[model samples]
Target: MGSLALKDLTEKCTTKYKKISVTKDIILLKNYCHEIANKSLQILEVNLNNVESFKNISEATLALTILINRKRVGDVQYLKLNNYTLPQAVNEEHIILTESERALSKNFKRVVTIGKGSKAVPILIFSGCDKLKIF
Candidate 1:
């Protein structure tokens, strides 16, 4: 399931149960936690008007907690699911990287640069797409 969907499910579960019940499968729990974090980040990226700012620090800590708790869950392969961060792996790709970039720039009012030393990359916001000339 997608991160947002998983997070919605997790939120519902947490609300319904009030307290989370742990199972023997630590991998599953860690996966859920990681997805939750990704979902939170997605919400921020979308820039929904009614949504409050998502807290990254707390979410990161929560994910770490789950990882620590699931020590015996084998080598859990955690994957981050988000449009700009990681592209969909399947042949039928849902997200187009360039289009996603444009959409995110319009919606979130920021560019999502994917690379090392991205902070060092100079940001020159322009009036039109063609007007953008990165040196």
Candidate 2:
């Protein structure tokens, strides 16, 4: 998935669930699944044999979300899904506002832009928590 899509998904999750804390790594994994889905869509046009890959990706994404919720409540120490160990955190930065994303929030206020030239796409802005906000 592109950075913009990842950012949008991350924002969506964080904003929608105000009580739950979402980490950067989880967002990255979600984006990876999204990319897989995108690839699967492309592959579907060529061959139906790739359908199983799409199913697996969907299952993995669901499992990851479940594990995250478990971890959030201090019920798990490590995230292990599909026989793979996921790091609690990633060193890479996940939040970087693009020009278009920045335009969605003017003067630190969330605004929805619509229609025509120079209009910003609507986006949710998360603040207060450093982990939630894209810098």
Candidate 3:
């Protein structure tokens, strides 16, 4: 594939993604994904394929840079899937997107606490992913 402007790439991705039931919050994810796909040799490098059952949000964010930055700096390798279930509730979990909870609130399976002290924020809540990475 040839090099593409981020805007153009984002537009293309928007067009493609519109066909799916994917939520609008994932626009960030899609824009990043398209940027990575256009700029890298490995098409799937910046996709959610790196997400694993035990992976944390921070680690996944780092992986996404390789997947969406449009600069190929990392080796592309497929991650194995692990079956897991979503938790009903987890304390101190962070939900970055304000409205994410509404869409996936019922599907949470795990949580991660963030920042200083025990009183810190719950920075991440995740749904079970057997073989998918959704940024």
Candidate with the greatest lDDT versus the true structure: 2
- Give the Cα-based TM-score of candidate 3 against the true structure: 0.25
Q: Which stretches of candidate 3 lie over 4 Å from their true place?
A: 1-30, 34-103, 107-110, 126-135
Please give the lDDT score for candidate 2: 0.44
The order by descending TM-score is 2, 1, 3
Model 1 / residue 120 / CA error / Å? 34
List model 3 lDDT by residue over 1-135, tens digit each.
445787788788888744553566467775654455343323345554644422444344444433333323322122112311234443454455457665666554332323233332322223322123533
Candidate number of the best TM-score: 2
Provide the lowest-lDDT 10-residue window in model 2: 126-135
Q: List candidate 1 segments past 4 Å from native.
A: 1-24, 48-57, 69-135
Residue 67's lDDT within candidate 2 is: 47
Question: Judged by lDDT relative to the true structure, which candidate is superior, 2 or 3?
Answer: 2
- Distance from true position, residue 71, model 1, in Å? 12
For each candidate, what is the lDDT? 0.40, 0.44, 0.40
TM-score of each: 0.26, 0.28, 0.25
Kindly list the per-residue Cα lDDT of model 2 for residues 61-133, writing each as its tens digit: 4444344333232122122232122222322322466677556433232323332354433222222211211
Runs in model 2 deviating more than 4 A are 1-22, 64-135
**What local lDDT does model 2 show for residue 100?**
73
lDDT of 1 at 81: 23
